[model samples]
Target chain A: MNAIAETVMLDSASTSVTNAVVMDCRIEKIFYGDFLAVRDSRVPIKKNKIIGFIGPSGCGKSTVLRSLNRMNDLIPIFRFEGKVTYHGQDIYDRKVDPVVVRRYIGMVFQQPNPFSMSIFDNVAFGLRLNRFKGDLSERVEQALRGAALWNEVKDKLKNSGLSLSGGQQQRLCIARAIATEPDMLLMDEPCSALDPIATRKVEELMLELKEKYTIAIVTHNMQQAMRVADTTAFFAVDISQGSRTGYLVEMGATRQIFEQPQQQLTREYVRGEFS
Target chain B: MNDSHLSAESILQAVAGDAPRNLQRAPLEIRTLKSGALTALTWVMAVLASIPLFSVIYMLLVEGGSRLDWEALTALPPSAFEAGGGFGNAIIGTLVMVGIATLISVPIGILASVYLAILDPNSKLAQTARFLAKVLTGFPSILAGVFVYATMVVTMKSYSALAGGMALAVLMLPTVILAAEQAMMMVPKKMKDAAFGMGCTRTQVIWNVVLPTGMPGILTGVMLAVAGAAGESAPLLFTALFSNYYLSSLTEPTASLSILIFNFSGMPYDNQIELAWAASLVLVLIVLVLNVVARFVGRQKF
Candidate 1:
């Protein structure tokens, strides 16, 4: 590592780690118009750690992530019986504001969704919406730099964000997400649509970001989990008893889960034995 | 056979050394026939549509030419055909009624659209409201005039410009709602999600993102409604009551150009008929300008 990398790591280490857990969701049940999506489940998210949720498509991985911030509330038919807490506060409490929770827990979607605006405006959008009164230009610059996008777009800040290449647009979305200084970043297959080189750059950004914020990522790519995750959770669909709800098969440190899984399903999944 | 194959191979090698060429090009005869048919059909339809429009405009200019004087356009309203006055009061009266109608319809229509686009997608009430708006759009204009006459004019003891404008507004409400709703629906869902994800409320998302994005469409809808109001003679005949003097208030009986068009066109006097033709030309011109403005606004991407 170079001097700048060393300095960033050192400064990050010096800051006392938060003992408070990031997300503690105990979902009793999740439903989509009378269809139970996820059965009873509990997950404890550690602070400042990268937790990867690896599962097959339609296994309710994205559904769980959306529930963490109450994003599913927008769908009128989406019902749930759950108790989710962040920093020990009940997130589903009637007084709690999902909008405020979403602001604090930002998300980057599967596809790059930079607003159809200038690159600078895309980064500054969340900040302006949240009514951040500080130096907005410097904040935007810092966010772009943090997202590893500042060098490529430094001189073209006024250009449309939509005009950027796909990889750059994803990074611009990351820049937009971090502009608000959220506590945790939830990324849903952020690199699934990118090329290998772009994926590598995003992976590097994620590793660099782990020192500062907690991240929960849902991915279909197992190698991605092996590469960037500190902890990994394996989910499997239960087709028996006419129940297709996804359940957490196993979870452990990335090395232990890959090397010695507790459940046969997890082992088989890790070795690509069954989907 | 071997000798023939060897000779073909030699020819192929010679051709490959330069460039390969297509042995079979498109049939020139078939392409020529198709192009000829298409070109003839295009010209025939173009001329067929253009002729009636040009001829009507030409005849209108010829028949209404003598009455297009400055005095005829600028002078006050005349009760008698011998007075030879202009339809100035009628023009002003038309403008004022349309303006009031636009003001009454725009806010209600846009609000209804916003509600339908944002709130009605998943709700049964919203679906019902959408159905009602669609049905209301196809309602007859004369029936609207009758309804307003029964409700407002009968209660107030007289038909007034306010009653006329109200009838027009009722006729325009469904159109304005439907057009504005379509505009609001064109706003990307991702934009709304981004706004809401930024800690903004649903109301804030509608106001800041959806409304601004749909601004040009809302303007076009309002313009169409106003223009459609310009040609409605049936609604105004019972409401405006054909005044001979200037309209000072909304509640007073007023004479609009459409009402005058209907009344003067029925008279025995030749002068009144000429005046009616001039007013018709002016009405058509006003509607034409409004449509042009709407088209220009619709072309803007924002």
Candidate 2:
């Protein structure tokens, strides 16, 4: 219904998105019921880059990431003021469907939650949901190949997606997200459940995926953000009033955020000195 | 004997004692004795609870077993002055009416439950639907019969199998909806969230994730409802009335196992009494099979 937003979305599809903002969350506030979960300032996710959000336990890294795709809208109490635009179209706009927003912005959860369906079906799920007109098996293979899991799971594509190892299941989830051809991917602590070797594999996959799609990741592991993120946003909890609230402390090139963080909180967090 | 994640040294320091062996593994302590006494009491009470059920089964076997023959299952019932016969027509009619009830109830119950439990659970309308469904579960079967009698039977101007089924469907709908709502609710939020994240609409999530995962439990509820419907005579009394002949049309009078038993048990003739006993055996056997089937269905076979 917003004519300007619709035209911008259409125009962006044809134009080069180099240095362009694919998704932006310039929110004034994020609320879950009455609690101020995130006192949001501007946190724009740029095109074709992995932006890793890192913070303490209560800090709203995942909240910001979820808001990017309007995934927070699924939570009954989740309410936000201000724009979360995908391709310059305000996703929270009354007419902009969250279902459509999600199709363009995929998410991989903290846990490797493969549907109870088979591996091939799991990858094909999104495409099927969108009624994809392509050769489904080929797209599933391509996505699986893209996630660097094709060789391991290609032979047993018919098996339950849950039948794979934890690492492979995570990769299968990656394949599933990409098969829908989303312009971006959001991962929430994707490697927390994995071993060091598996974590390394996922980290590698993220760097590879950044070439084709924008990525926003929330991670507890600072070293992981250092490894994979092009830009890193450090969030910190403000506990001055007894009730805690998370806010973006600093967002810069990953190196600067790690080596020369502008904020004292960022410095303390990266140095593992949380008081 | 051995240690894994928590080494023996850590375990010794953590427990400061003999571990699981130290943790109340006494053979004859007073607390242990009390637990054993309670366990014995539980088993006794369980057996006590089973007594009535087993006794009824025993009574059916002793009183009804003799007349449960091939002819009693496949042949038409005898006339009032006749000697020996079967209630095959009754069996057919019962199956047909229950089939209709199931057809009516299953979809409506499942869809309405999805609305109540999944879509708008906290809404006032959903709350009212839930409350009404619970109330209906406790509703008297005779009341259901009366409702159908006014709405269906009087309008149709004939005691028909369709009317009987409508009455049974009313009785069944509440049970199916409640059980199914609970079943759908029990599907993990994680699974649904995954579906939603994959760009599925709410309807898609319910159809693709919620229903499949909740299916075994839903089937159990359905089978229970079916068993309950099959055993009701009061609902069929005014709605279906009775038919001694084979059910030719769904719009005509029908005979059910419950009604046959109800009718023949009060008859003066010995043959009719024997036929009633045989019918009771059949009905009990049907309910027993349904319970067994429900168990198998309830298990996560997938």
Candidate 3:
């Protein structure tokens, strides 16, 4: 009976977690010192699929995204009780190096934060960090091409990464991430700082990138989730205890969550009905 | 039972049809005059603040301008009873000792600050070191000389250039460390985050991202510390003592511009007094150049 119950539970998640290769992990809790920030998030990211996390402001979507690659470890007060695994290995294990985890699961932040280096150097940073023995120029070119920033930036590879347009700089950052050949990419609202044209370009890039790398993005735009995501997770704030903490309300196919959500909160959010 | 809706035009609300017009403010001239008064007050205070600085420059130029010759910089200091000699050795000594002090303090200060501001900033030891650095910034310079006099001077069994440099290094450390910490802290969190997200180790982040980004500010701090160390006389008084001739080695007594002025100002000879003024001018110029360079370096974008 317990085995049947577990099978039903796994089926309910809808992403079908039977494939045990990559991005099969769950987050139990994230804390800032003693206060619980986010809890019980169970959207196991799948391979070669783009998953979008959509929520209102301060709903811990970004926080959840940050925890995936162990980026939250940079904060001294940040604490976590979670199993974030990659390739069937628990990343938060004591023996695992956060640096190595970061290398394998690359991230792009909200702001276009290209290091203060030439465009070529920006892309080459990750490659150099891993001490890649391949042809560096060829690798940088491939990463830039993969990010769709090659045609515009190929001529000015020596220019500072900051000299590019905001969208270009973000693309440059993406190039920087994939240069190390990470299997998964975590992007935290990568287009919030950009304009409409740039946003469109980035959305297209994400669709193309899904052919190769698993992607999880946190976004404020519901239309964005509909446009690009294969699956979507809705995070909502819980304030019953006079404190705001975020929890995942539902995770399902993007169309199902938008059209016929299982939870009332998800329904209200999709309809833009709740305050 | 009394939950009646109150609409805009209900309950004898009689004045609801008119649109809101432009609001009146204070008369334009009165407002302008008030702003002008504030501006004038600031200008007056600014002039008042600059009076002492300008007066000092004027005094220095009048007293030392004519006496500042090539000879004053290239010749040895005049004796108590003699005339027409210069502090060539003192200029060389000041540069050498200040160089030594800079070499000793900058690396240590920058590393300590990296620990305080970047690596393990919240640890009890870092907090204590930060506090101690702040306290030492206010500690008396004479005490630094006295402390060095007890340690290096006593152990080396002589008053030497090395001792004076050590004394200045003691005074320069806190300034360098504190200023460097502020600079490192000012490096954008995003840049460091980007570097870390790129899989940089802590040391790699410091070396590649933090240090290079903070270089302008760090250089500014180091230059300011060097200026402060250059102008200090009390620290060198006991540690380096004074010499009339050129330094033979790092172990012998050294002559510095500040010490030269100190020794010459007390002499009864007119030429010695004039040389003192000249040395003061050079010292002031050195400090000014260092400050200007700090501003220049600090203003760089990357």
Candidate 4:
């Protein structure tokens, strides 16, 4: 275990020289009031890379994803031990504001939740909230283009965001997230509600977006993880004596985790032997 | 082979003089009968409920129609036993008093409701405020009048339009707060989550997202409060009293349609009585128009 830690530290130290470490999460445990939700986890999200979290239902993948950006702080009962650092600053420190953390680490939810406003307003919402001083129309256009939705929606910018199709709405949500220019994006099952074609589009968009922002996504679809993620973490729930608590099983390069998993549980998971 | 087996099974059933026992059951005629009876009953009940409304409207049109005229609408009430007068001053007075009341109550009510629905919704103070608002909705309109009479009219040393407006404001506040809170609460939680996810401050989310989304419903609440305030006669009696002339200032006693109807309805003169009916018709029309406007506004999408 010490050797493994040494190796991981060496690997991270070498990677930090070339690529920025956007978020370094060392979550000892997470609790919803008195109930423990997630056990220990250690994951370092690299800059400009897609990191996928694959786990079965109730394995706390989304919980860990949310905690990275302090999105879990919205729930009054939620509390976590240990530290989450963004750009070498402890985000969970007393002086740190969760709102500020969220501004820097934007999130996209499972279901596409576009505000009931014009398409332009939906993309411009985050920018407006942050009081973006740049040219608003140009910024909105840039965001829509970044999400690959500008051509389809440019003519109907005045129309309601809800008027868009399911796939387009998800892309709009992505545009809304990126408009604020956050350094990292946390997506929790973003493609779960979308169709296959929409899922493909989103996967392609994720690849394109990884050039500019770090992304951490939690998904149930292992194939999606294999397709889009550079790094993958497998999570599993321990239901010993009926006390269910989620813990990280393994983390490695996507191909290594899928093809030559170091952990037996990860191998079983990748083999589709058991959820 | 399948057809031969089916024919054999049919032959066996025919020999038994009844179709296979598990194959089918008798049709449910009772369901159709009960549904038909219930649908007819619902129609009958609906018609019965509408009868009183239609009858009141019919009475208003028949009794007040003869008194209505261009002059009646644009003139002040004549002396007792005199003819060819209207409640024009009363109409203007109602508008002024209700308008003032709306202006006072709407901002207070909407802001209070936003506090209850969005800010510190579970706090002890908000819970108390919510309970008080619910209790206030059932407060007697006459008591509202008396409240204004004591606080404004008595302090100022006379019944005035300002006092009347204050009384109506009190009556309207609770309704607006309750309805506005409900409307704001009806905004989906997911929308709020989305707003908050974008790192919007609580105030920004409420103002930019929640309020706009809930505007139609809030407008309906405001319109309903205005309609209720417009038709209130008991509250105006102590605060507004009665006036025969056009309103000079808010400090002076004002004429309202409800007050005019109340005062003239009891007079022995036929012309005064007819004028009272005319005022009642006008008051009803105003309330009806307000309700219709509420529906129209409520139907609008954000």
lDDT of 3 by residue, A224-248 (tens): 9999999999999988867788999
Model 4 sits at a Cα RMSD from the real structure of 5.8
The TM-score values for the models, in the order shown, are 0.83, 0.88, 0.86, 0.90
Q: How well does candidate 3 match the true structure, expressed as C-alpha RMSD?
A: 7.5
Q: Which pairs of residues have clashing backbones in candidate 3?
A: none
Which structure is stronger by TM-score: 1 or 3?
3
lDDT of 1 by residue, A1-275 (tens): 13323433554565456544567878888999978788767878887889999987777888888888888898889987889987667889999989878887888888887766689988998888777778999999999999999999999999988899989999999999888777788888999889999999999999998877889999889999999999888877877758688777787898899999998888889899877
Evaluated with TM-score, which candidate comes out highest? 4
lDDT of 4 by residue, B53-88 (tens): 999889989999888888888898898767688989
**Candidate 4 global TM-score:** 0.90
Candidates sorted by DockQ, best first: 4, 2, 3, 1
Off by over 4 Å in 2: A1-18, A151-156, A163-165, A240-243, B1-28, B58-66, B288-301
Minimum summed lDDT over a 10-residue window in model 3 chain B is located at B1-10
DockQ of each: 0.36, 0.55, 0.47, 0.57
Best candidate per DockQ, number? 4
Worst 10 residues of 4 chain A by lDDT: A1-10
Please name the candidate that would achieve the greatest lDDT relative to the true structure.
4
Tell me which of candidates 1 and 4 scores higher on lDDT.
4
lDDT of 3 by residue, B14-56 (tens): 5645433544665577887899899999999999999998998
Ranking by TM-score: 4, 2, 3, 1
Which regions of candidate 3 fall more than 4 Å away from where they truly are? A1-21, A133-137, A151-159, A238-245, B1-29, B81-83, B289-301
lDDT of 4 by residue, A1-275 (tens): 23323433565676767566768999998999988999889998887889999988899999999898887887889999989877678999999978767777788999999988999999988887776777999989999999999999999999999989999999999999998777789999999999999999999999999987889999999999999999999999999848789999999899999999999899898999988
